[model samples]
Target: MSAAPELRRNSLDLPEAVEAARAQYAARRPRSAALHAGALEVLAGGNTRTVIAYEPFPAAMVRGEDCRLWDLDDHAYLDLCGEYTAGLFGHSEPRIHDALHAVLRRGINFASVGPGEEKLARLICGRFPSIERVRFTNSGTEANLMALTAARAFTGRAKIMAFRGGYHGGVLTFPITGASLATLPLPFVMADYNDNDSAAAVARANAADLAVILVEPMQGSGGCIPARPDFLATLRALADETGAVLIFDEVMTSRHSAGGVQARLGITPDMTTLGKYIAGGMSFGAFGGRADIMALFGGKLPHAGTFNNNVLSMAAGGVAMGEIFTAEVAEALYQRGEALRARLNAVGAAAGVPLSFTGIGSMLTAQFRIPAPDRPYVPTPGEEQLRELFFFDMLEAGIYLARRGMVALSLPVADADLDRFVAAVADFAENRAELLRADGVTG
Candidate 1:
């Protein structure tokens, strides 16, 4: 409208463009700015969740309905974040709301066991093929912790083979370049994802003491990198040969289908960990597998949590699994997600830019790297700057996605909203292709 502000790497500078975007963002959300300032006086860095903490502070959302959200500044946005895949039913899924409300009427904590837990357990066992005997947790992080603990106890071994780019939970993260400092103090043998040889070598080296081979069918926090089917098969074989348990962390990827990516690939692991959308947006997590392994929890291995099977989570999870997320619904959602990702990638390709979206079924990450990362965490030089700029641009366009360029589609997001997101990407490509390709070489 006003000649596009004329910012460039060799001229005005890419940082100049970012500054301009930040200025616009700040101007539009004065109220949110004050709120953040106030939060800074209390919360560390003005945030509770690390992922949501970004530069210039994140928006405080006030309300949401269906696939839309209203920020504190009263700016309406199409919610593309979907609460990091935990909000699959969207802001106001009547079914989930009703279930929670009904649970409240039945009563709060009985200080013992409840009937809803059994219903939820049955639904989870029925849907997920690898889960024969399941146990609940307050979060996916807990689920993975217990799963790994079980493996160690069952095998009488301590070593675990975890992928470099894999993330089981907050305390169990393995980054591509190096390991996270917050990672649990456990004997971890890290291998590269999507590399059979790397995994094989590690598994063999730790064979004697290897307790489990933990992986994600599709890496979520690791930029949505999908593992090659053969790589998974190799892990399965290696686990069997080494007498190690194979655990699939489907906390996020379980949204791929009713039975998760495991069912789609026809490869069953010894154990499975699940969370995110499983409880219909309520806080929930579960870990289960061979009866012999889970049976330990009931006997020797003690699994204790104040709200492991809370009424709200149990009821909501049961309704979500049994009614809302039926097999047919899963199949349809999967198809829509596949089609949406294809269209988004096509827009990037057509723009002749290096940007691409990588993921499976309703989950995706917009990245600047091409050919999609196979293993090593070494990122493309200018990949991050491009995505940071894209994040600001999309936010300005009223599309609420993760600052890290994550997009998790909800069931309520309409086809028209999809078109709008694609259009926004197209505009970003056209407007920033030169700066993106120049790799920010400043004058």
Candidate 2:
């Protein structure tokens, strides 16, 4: 199906819009500004995650519940960022909170496996057909590291291939340098996302040394782009041809479905790395795949971590996956996401804006394009300019859009909230032409 119809472009004034956004934000978040100034003395840029850092100051979060968050400055927002897509059940969910209390009271950690670990593991394997056995880690990054290590051990190969835009999170350890980042280790060979020929060429060239091919079913950090059906099938074929293990890093995309993008796409990886929503807004991660490959860690390879299956994380995750997140809930998210996409496209069409929106299940992104009548190309920086403009303007309109073009939809984001989000996008579409003009990107 096509996106909504197009709209006419509005004349914009660049400098004025930038100044307006700056002044408006500075006034609304005075507490954050003051805190940022004080924090600069001790912490670099007064924040933690680089992604959260923005122009002026970062909005420090004070508290969160369900889908709403209150920033340090006492400003409340409908949290679309969702802790960078980690708080899947929304923040401080009741099911997980209650489970945590019970688990913590019983004990925090034991050197041996907890029964809750098996329950969570079973939940994961039951959802995804490929994962015969699973192992827990503390984060997605660690889970990926484990997957890569296990893949190499099983195949007896040294090199690994990953996609250019795909992120598997341990480039430094594998010496897999990211195309977008300057970090090192630098051993990974890159393939383009959604391109079958490009992936085939990489597989052919590295056929001998390649131990694994790690990919994200949908590239989250690269921009919420889904892998084409042909691309996934091609990779799986290549893995079979080259005798390389195929791994899907489903950290961000796991919330989209019970089995994640792999199942939704109807492709299975040999191994999978999962995190984010698994712990119900807490820190946790796990990786699993074919039983033969995953069992290497127990006696064949030997890997250990102090908190691999920490009792509390296991307990909370078991409850979240077992009871809180249901097939009905996931389907609800997909429906809501579809509505949001349609609304955004409609506004873009009415405004003559090249509003191209695409997403699978619950994840979505809308990119603005220049004034081409049909099939308009995304603006030179793709949609970055519009993303920045919308980010600032939406905040003024009282919406908390992440600096990125994405908004993670939580279960609590109801009809009213969706209305507000759609209205904000329309406001941006009407005003962005002017905002860009003011910023000096004139025709």
Instruction: List per-prediction Cα lDDT, in the order shown.
Output: 0.87, 0.75
Highest lDDT: give the candidate number: 1
lDDT of candidate 1 at residue 365, scale 0 to 100 = 91
Q: List the residue pairs that clash in candidate 1.
A: none
TM-score of each: 0.96, 0.90
Q: For model 2, how many clashes?
A: 17
Name the regions of candidate 2 deviating beyond 4 angstroms: 1-12, 170-186, 370-383, 434-443
| lDDT tens per residue, model 1, 51-143 | 998778688899999999999999999999999999999999998999999889989787788888999999989988888999999999999
Error of 2 at 214 (Å): 1.2
| Candidate 2 lDDT tens digits, 1-443 | 11112212343344444555666678778989999999889987677667788888888888888888888878778888766678777876777889989987887767887798899999999987679999889999889988889999999998888776556664422212334443345457877677788889999999998899988887776556777778888999999999999999889888777788777778988999999878787788899999999778778887789988888888888888889888778777877887787778788778765654566656776555433112112245534555665677667666776686677787777789888888777766665645433332222
Q: lDDT of candidate 1?
A: 0.87
